[model samples]
Structures are given as structure tokens and as C-alpha cells.
Target chain A: MARPDNARYQETHEWGRLEKDGTVTIGITDFAVDQLNDLTFVDLPEKGDKVTRGEAFGEIESVKAVSDLISPVSGKIVAVNDGVDGDDFSALKKDAFGAGWLIKVKPDNAKELDKAKSLADYEKQLAEEAH
Target chain B: MQETPLRAEHERLGARMVDFAGWYMPVTYTNIMEEHRRVRTKVGLFDVSHMGRYWFSGRDHIKFIDKLVTNDRAGMKPGQIRYSLMLNGQGGALDDVLVYGAGDDATMLVVNAGNRPKIWDWIQRQRKGFVVDVTDMSTDYAMIALQGPESANLLNKVSEVDTKALKYYRFTRGTVFGEPEVLVSRTGYTGEDGFELIMPQAKAAYFWRELLNVGESLGAGPAGLGARDTLRLEAGMPLYGHELEEHINPLEAGLDWAVKLEKEDFIGKDATVAIKAKGLEHRLVGLNIAGKRIPRQGQDVLRDGKKVGTIASGTKSPWLDEIIATAFVPANMAEVGMSFQLEFPGKGTRTMKPEEMRQTALVVPMPFYKRPGKK
Candidate 1:
């Protein structure tokens, strides 16, 4: 899947999109979902939880492995995606960008996302990893 | 890392390759769940050439083997295969192996991939006075496992061998794809009735493609190590590094049947007898967790907020659709109906209390998903 140009990505494969309300939506990239195939369970932080940039906030468990869900920006989580955290994962499996957003955080500083990689830069990193 | 004979074939199939036991092997073709389901319901092929294969010959072959392994190999009929464990002097399991009684003079042993080097060295050191010639045929021969309920039908359609006549744990030499000297055995790690084929390394790719071509309509496709692990775990088979280790004995691993104490003077017989007489301190037990959280290896098994044991192996069983695991707990707590807690550490850097992050685990019967019509 082509990454959205408006969003910024983390080297760990997380994406953060800034909304008009100054809150940033967070979710893992399609490459991450593909790598962690057959997800069995997902653990997300609760609403009002604090998240630090480049830190693990939660975890994602697949059949074969367990990977941490890294935060792209440091902030206070205003909302958590109940749909992804619950038993059903159809929304996360179908669309990881829009419907599969894990958490919405009110950032301490919106400039924290500036350290994230752009779409072109993230794709380049993925390409190099492929080789 | 070492590459198998079918490495190119795996790459062509777009397999997700990983370094397993110092060998470049495929972990999955697509996803583990799909491939695991295919094996349980239909059929699946696996490239298992990385496992060590050794051929034994000479007059004292059986004698040498009987002394090294724990099983009673003296009574094994021709073409019979028996699972056995090789233990150190302290009664700790060195490696679990398969002993193939090819004939009165010739025998074969298949060892785990990770322990190939260690076992090879052990065998060389132990063959001192015995007049047995052991040849490592791992590179010269390639192994493939054809598994599932539809495996027999698929094998019958492609090979000249009458798979229907082959009894469980029995093998036959035949030709596949017009290539001669293929040894087909009715044995597998998975609980399903399947076949393990050993053929020349040079003909591996050709035979693999031919089998897939003929078996495709029978719902046969290549499965990778990921599926193989889940399938075996569901079948309640113990893996080497997880359940069996150099410090873990077969008796504690729930593999007592494979360790024959009645046999005369095996390597670890005295220690095993002592262990049996003194009674077991710890035992391996199957566990079923309450939720979807998987209990990974080395995770603490808690009882009353205290560490009581360690998880040996665990996974979200694809067939059973439950969180099943095996753990080494006190023998007194190894009975069914026993309940414990599996501690899951918080992923965040912040410290959390033990009681805050834990899952309920219950002791349950193993062979979690036995194949239909199997006793």
C-alpha cells in the first residue's frame, strides 16, 4: 500500500497524522501489519494514558511473534480504538491508515512529528531493507 | 548460514526466509494460520532438508546404536521407525532422534537441525570400540514432509509406492517422478497420518515441483517452518529447544515412553532408573489460557503471586483457536484442574505491579487437536 503523503512515519513502521483539532492519530504501517501476519491479539493503552515519542505504548501479538507498538509522537492519549483492541480485527486488517488508527493523542508539542520520516523517505528505507 | 537444496524453490515461492538453527530456511509462504489450516484439513509440503540424516553400517551397527539411544531398538522390525532420546550421563536429554531400522546391518538416525553438529561430535567420540561406520548424509540427501489427512491420496497419485499398504512408522523404498531410491516413511511430527520422504539432494527440486504439480488438485501446497511449528504444537509434540534440552530429561518432558529403562545398560539408564525411583520433582503439563494472550517461552508461571514454574512452549493454536501452552511446573501441580497465572510484563518502560498484568492459565489434557478417528 502506498503511504499517505500527509502523514509522517517512524523508522519502526508507525505513522502519525495531524488533524485540524491539533490531535495526532497513530497507527502502524501496512508493512508492519504484513510482517506481523495473522494477528491474534492487540493491546492498546487506555484513554488519558501518556505516550512518549519513540517509546513503546502497547503490544501487538501475531501467531508467530510479538512486536511492540511504538509511538511516533509524545502526547496524552485522548482516545483509543476500541474496534482494533476488541476481538474483531477486520477494520485493522482492511485499512490500517484510516479505520485502523490505534490511538489519538493530544501532543505536548506538534513539532515532535517533525522528527518523523516523510513518505518518500520511509519508502526509501523500506526499499533498502528489502535489499 | 547454510542453505538447503530447496532454498531456490523457497525463494521462488516468495517465502519469508529466516535464519533457523544457523540455516537459511523459510518461515512461511503466506501466513502461518492459513498454512497450518491447510495441513490439518487438506495437505501441505515442507522442505525439511536441514535436519541431519546419518546412515549406519557395519557388523556392530545395531549394537552401537542400542548403547547410545534410550529406546529398545533390538526388537524393531525392518523398515520400522522408533522415536528415541539420547541422553548424557546425568540423564539429561542431549537430543531426541528417530531410529530407522533399515535392515539387520544398516540403520539410520535423523537428528534435529540445531543439534546436528553437537550430535555428530558425540557420535564420533562414542564410536571408539564399536566397529560401526557412520556417514553423515545430510548434504547428499534431502528430506520433505508431506502431511495432512489428504496426504496418502496425494502420495498415491504421484508415486509408484502403494502408500495404502504402508503401516504407521513403516517406510518403503520406491521411485518418485521416475527417480529411483526414494525412501517414504509413514511418520510425521504432526499427529496426522503423513509421509516423510528422503531422496537424493540433486533430484530434490525436480521431485518437489513434480509432487506439487500432481498434488495441487488434492489441496497440496508448500508450507513453511511457521506452520510446521504450530501444527506440531497442536499435536502435542515436544520440540527440542523448548521441551527437550541438555539439562531436561525425557522423563520430565513427558517422553517417558520413549525412554526404555528395561533395556540393558544404555547411556543414561542408571540415572533414569534413579530418577524414576526417587520420583519426579517437576513435570511438563499442557495449559489452556483464559484469553487470547499467548504465554511465550521463559515466561513466569505464577501461583499465589509467586513464581512456581516456567513456560516451555506456547502459542495461539490455529486449529483449536485457543491459547494453548506447555509449562514445567511442580509435579504435584501438574494434574488437570490445576490453575495458575501467567505473568505478562508491561511493554512500556513504566514499572507495573505483577498482579496488574497477568492472565489466568489452567492445566489441561494435551494432544489438544487430535486428528479424527485417532485413538
Candidate 2:
């Protein structure tokens, strides 16, 4: 799927979207999910946990390897996605952008999202990586 | 990086290639779980050309081989294959190998890809008094494994050799897909019935494509090394660097059956006998953890809050959907139903207590998933 046009992305393939209520919704991109094929477990932070920008807040384990889920913006996690947290991964596998949002964070500073790449820039980075 | 004969075919199939033991090989075509299940229930093809294949001949072929490996070669019938471990003088394993007894004058030794150079040098150094001609034919042939429950049916459809007549651990030369002189062996690392075919390197691409073409209707597909590892782990097979290491003897690794102590003195025979007499300090045991988080290699195994063992190999089994692992613990603690704690790497120094980072691991029987109705 085309990365949602409004979402800001990190080089590590995480995407975050800013809402009118000033909370940011975060989830991993399709590319990251594809690379981590056959995911067996996903460990996410609980609600009210503090997350720092450009640091690992959780982990994702596939059949072969384990990778970190980096945060794009520092914030306190206000809500965790119960739909994709535990043994069930149907939401994350079905629509990674829409229903698969991992956490909702109330950012320390909304301007921190400015450091992330735009949708076009993220696609450009992905294109260059293909070569 | 070294390339296999079927490298181009793997690329065409959209395989995710990675550097494995200095050779560029496919890790997965689609996904590891899908390929793993395919091998368990149906059939899957694997390009194992990267492994070292050495052909031996001459007057002392059997004598030289019998003196180098742990398994008995004197009683091996023609066309039979035996799994053996080549060891150092200290009884430490050099490499686990498959000894193929072709005939009175010929033998073939297949070694792991990573240990090819070391094994080759060891053989050369050890053959001072024996008259054996060893030829390294790893690059000259392509080894393909057709594995699963439906493998025999698939082989009978494409090859002239009658799959029904081939007994387990036996090999035969036959024509496959109009390609003559193909060596078809009914042996595999997977716990299911399967065949490993050795063919000329030049015709590897043709045979790979043809096999998929004909076997596709029988639910056959291409698998990669990722699936190969999980399948072998579930089968309780000892990988070279993991379960069978340079410092780990066959007895400590639960491979006592393959080590023939009564046979004539081979390399490490004296040390092996001494080890048996001294009894085992630590023994390899299987662990079943009750969670999704896998216990990785080198992780600490604990008993009553004290570190006592280490994980050798572990995976979230695709077939059983459970976290199965192999570990080495004190021989007294290796019994089934014995429980221990597996210390997982804590997440970012957020330690609550010792018990928080540890998960309970139970000692279980090996070969966690056995193919039903097969020996």
C-alpha cells in the first residue's frame, strides 16, 4: 500500500501521523513488515510508558531474526493498540497503516515530527535502497 | 561471495539472498514458515550445492575413511550412507559428515560448507600413510534435496528409478528428467522421507526448473536455508557450529549412537573412550518454553536462580507452533520433566527483579516433532 500520504517516516521504516487533537499515531511501514516475514511475536510498550525519539520502544520477532521498533517522536504513550499487541496479528497483517497503529502518543513537542521524512522523501529513500 | 550453479534461478524466483558461510545463497523464497510447512506435509526443493562433496578412491579408501571418522565403515554395504563425526585428537568434533559407501573402490564424504577448507586440510595431513585419492568435487556438482511426506511419489513421477524399491539411507544411480547418471539418495536432514539428488553442475538450472515444473502439481515448491534450519532443529539433528562444535564431543551432544567406541582406533578414539569411562558431566537436552519469545544461542539457562547451562539452538517451531530449543545442562538435570529458567535479554535496563527477565523452561524429549508412521 502507498504509505499514507500524511504520515511522516523514519529511515528505520516507522511511520507516525499527527492528528488534530495533537496526539500522534505510530506504526511500522509495509516494508518493515515485509522484511520481517512470518512474525511470531510483537512486544509493545504499555500505556503511559515514556518513549524517546530515535530509540527502540519495543521489538518484533520473526522466524529468523529480531528487530527493534524505533520511535519517530518522543512522547508518553497514551494508548496501546490492543488489536495487534498479543498473540493475534490479524490487524497488523491486514492493514498496517489503518487498524495496525501500534500506539498513540501525546508528543512532548509536535515539532519533533518535522525531523522525520515526508512521504515522497521516504519513497525516494526506499527507491534508492533498491539499487 | 561464492555463487551456486542455480544462483540465477534463485534470483528469478525472487529469493531473499544472503551471505551464508561466504557463499551467496537464498535464505527464503517466500517465507520460512510456509516453506517449512511445505516440507512437513507436501514437498519442497532445496539447493544444497554449497556443501563440500569429496570423492575418495584407491586401495585404502575405506581404511583411510574408517580411521578418520567415528562411525564404523567396515560393515557398511555398498550404496549405504552413514552419518559420522570427524574429530580432532582431543575428541572434539571437527565436522559432522555423511559417509556414502559407493562400492569397494569408491566412497564419498559430504562435509559442511563452512568447514570445507579445514576438513580438506585435515584429510590431507592425515593421509600420509594411506593410499587414498581425494577429489574435491564441490563446485563440479549440484546437490538438491527433495524432502517431505509426498517426496517419494513426486520422485517416482519424474525419475526412472522406482522410489518404492529405494530403502532408507540407500542411494542409486538413475535417469531424472532425461538426465542420465543422476545419483538419487533416499536421505535427508528433515525428519520426513526424502531424497537428495546429485547431478552435474552444468545441468543444475535445467533440473531445478524441470523438477518444479513437474512437481508443482503435487504441492512442491522451492525452499531455502531458513526453512532447512527450522526443519532440522525440529528433527533434533545437530548442526555443526551449534550442537556439534569443535570443543563439544559427540557424547555430550547426544550423538552417542553415531560414535562407535568398539570400532578400531580412529582419531580421538582414545579420548572418546576416556570420556565414556569418566562419565558425562553435561548432556544435551531439549527444552520447551511456554511462550512466543525464542531462546537464542548462547542464552543462559538457569536452575533455581543460578546459571547452570547455555542454549545451543532454539526456534519457534513452525510445525508445532511452540518454542523448542536444545541446551546443555548438568547430566543430573537433563531428565525429562525437569524444569529450569531461561534468562532472556532484558529490555533496556528496566529490570524489576531476577524473576521478571526469566521464563520457565522444561526439559523435554528431543525430536520434538516426529513424522507420524515413519521410523
Candidate 3:
């Protein structure tokens, strides 16, 4: 998959893209989706729910198992994606980086984005893990 | 990890291999959801060579087997398959198995791969006085199951057997893909019209690829253990470790049809009769999740304010589009429409009482989804 150059990734397989409006959009990475087999249901936080970085904010269930969706950036949830809570799961598998963006948060600390891994670094980590 | 005859074939098809019961088996060829849906609607092939296949011969084989299992096999004709249970002295399950009467003096027993060694040892230890020649044919044969509604037509195209004429629970020896001596049995664990083929180990890969080639036009795909589990669960079939165990009796597991109490005597007959007379303490009941959360095994089931049972098997049903589970609870509380609280995370804290728990599951009928025809 073509990784977006501007998107930053967390070690736990979540990706965060900082928008021009100072809010960050978060979604699970394509690798996470592949590892999960097939995404059946995703539970997302309601609007205005506070999300902390490195903590579980919601959960994603696949056909075989369930996993926690870890937050990449800490902030108050400003907006949520309808697809996450809805029945259509194609977004999570097909357009994970774009239409599948799960939640948007107004960052508590803007400097935290620097700590996230770049697209190249994230791909390298995935390659090493596969070996 | 031990490998089946089709292990390389599974890897060639990009299967996700896992360590299942000490064997490296395919968990899924494509994705579990797609494979599961395909089998329910169409046809799918499963490589079940890892399951133990044992053969008993000699003049006293039938009598010897009748003394060992709970099912009545005295009237079983040649080329007939009977599902039965091997139990200990306490009526606890040793393993659930399928017995096939090959001829007047010979029989075959197919058992779970995980319980193969234990069942084999148990059978051998019990055969001291009987004049039966026991042989472990597990390593000598390969087993494959073609399951679903389209299985018969798809199999008829590749095999010499007239599968359409074969009745349910019937078997016959025939040629499949030019390989002779294949035991084609019209039986399956999936609640659909299907057949199982047992043949030589050397012909497994050849037949596996050939069957897929012939059935490709019919939308028959290679399914793995993942799809197998969901299909059986939807069929209300009890898995060995999940619904049965060394302590769980056939009566409580709802397998009374296979337990012949009216027969003269067999292993565990005395205890099973006693248990039947006294009634059951815990009954295996189906639980349908009222919410989207999955009911995981070993999760606490609460009634009122106390834990009443634990979940045995659960999965998200692709066919029903709902979460379903099987659990053992008090017989009185196992009635239909009875409600129980499932310990789902984020529903509430543990200190919350039963009524306070936000998420609840209802006791529903088993076989969350049934196929069109009756078995």
C-alpha cells in the first residue's frame, strides 16, 4: 500500500494525520487490518469523549477475535467517522488511510506528533517484524 | 509442528497456518468471514487428515466395539456411519467419535486429532478380553470433507460414486479422481448436505488439487479450521474440548440420541443410566447476545447477582449477523426467554449488580442457524 507521506504512525499500528485546522485524524493502519483478518465491527468513542495517548479509547472486533484501538494522540474527541459505528466495513479494509479515518481529536500537546514514526520508519518496523 | 498430507498445498494457497493441537494446520485459506459465508451458501472443502482414524478387524470386532461405545451398533449394516461417544466409568466423555461399519468383521472409528492418542490408548487398554485386531490407520489415510448445499453435485462431478443416491449417514467405497478405494461417506458436521472422503495418504494432495479444480466453477473454495469452527457452531454441533470434556456427560451435552440406555450394557452405561434417572444438574443452553459485543469462552454468566455459569463456545455468526454463544447453566434457568448478564467490558464495573449490567444475553434455542433440510 502507498503510505501517505504526511501521516505519522504509532508502534501499536494506529496512524495519525495532522490536519491544517490543528486537529488530528486517527485510524488503524492497513497492516493492523490485515493482521486482524476481517473487520466485523468497530466501536468508536462518542463526540466530546476525552482520549488519552497510549490508552485504549475504543475497540475493533474481527471475525476471529477482538482488539483494542489505541489512541495515537491525546485530546478531546471532536468528530467521529460514521463508518466506524455503522455496518459498512469496507472502509476499514479498502480505504483505511482516507475514508476509514476513525476519530478526530483536538490535540492537548501539539509536540506529541513529533514523537510518532514517519511512513518509512513504520514500514521498516513492519519488515523487521515479518522476518 | 506435525504436518498433514495437504500441509504444503495449504501453504501454496496462502493459508494462515497455526499450531492447532500440535499440528501445523491452516486456520484460513482466504479470510474466515468469506470462507464461512461461502460454505453456508455454497460448497467448501476441508482437509481433515489430522483427525485420528482407527480400524478394528477380526470376528469379534462388532461385539468389541459395542462394549466400548455408548451408541447401539448391533443393527448397523455395512457402509453405515453412526455418531457415538466413548466414555469413562463415570459417564464423562472420553471423546466423541464416528463409527463406520466397513463389513461384517471390520469397523472404523474417526476421532478428534487432539484426543487421538488418548482414545487409542483407552481403546487398547479395554480390548484385553475381546477378539479384535485393532490398527491405527490415522497415519495411513487422509480425510477430506466437502460440505455445504452444493457439495453433492460438486462431488459427483469428480468421483465415481453416485452421491445423490447415497442416503445420510451412509458410506461406500469408490474411485475419486482415478484413485481407488476411497471411502465416500455422506456425512458432515456442518448442517448441510455434504460428504466426507477418506483415502490413501499419498492421494491426498492430488485429490485436494483435483477437487478444487473441478469444483472451482461451482464456487467451491478451500476452507480452513476457522470456517470449520463457525460452521459447526452455527449447526449446533458440539466440539470436543468446547462442549464436551472428561467430566461433561453426553446427557448434559444434549447427545442423548447417541446414548443408548435401553441397550444391554456398555462402558459408562451404569453411571449414564443413574444420571438419566436423577435428572441433569447443568444443561447446555444457547445464549444470543443482545448487543454487538462477542461472548468469549470462560466469561462469567451472571443470574440475579451471582455467577451462574461460564461460556463454552461463542462466535459472531456471519449468517445470522449476530453474536451467539453456548453455555452451561442451571437446568431451571436454561429455559427459553430466560435472561442472563454477560460480563462484557465497558458494560459496567464488577461491583454492579445483575440488573445494573447494561449488556444482557437471552437464552435462545441451540443451532443459532439451521439449514433448509432436516438431518
Among all candidates shown, the one with the greatest TM-score: 1
Mark the regions of model 2 whose C-alpha exceeds 4 Å error after superposition: A114-131, B345-357
Tens-digit lDDT track for model 2 on B216-241?
88999999999999999999999999
TM-scores of the candidates in the order shown:
0.95, 0.93, 0.87
**What DockQ does candidate 3 have relative to the true complex?**
0.22
The best candidate by DockQ is 1
i-RMS, each model, one decimal: 4.4, 4.1, 6.2
Give per-residue CA lDDT, model 1, range B191-286, as digits (tens): 888999999999999888888899889988999999989999989899999999988889999998898888887898899899889999889999
Q: In angstroms, how far off is B151's CA in candidate 3? A: 1.7
Which structure is stronger by TM-score: 1 or 2?
1
Q: Which ten residues in a row have the lowest lDDT in candidate 3 chain B?
A: B347-356
lDDT of each: 0.89, 0.90, 0.86
Identify the runs in model 3 with alpha carbons over 4 angstroms from their true place. A4-12, A16-25, A46-54, A72-79, A104-131, B347-357
Worst 10 residues of 2 chain B by lDDT: B346-355
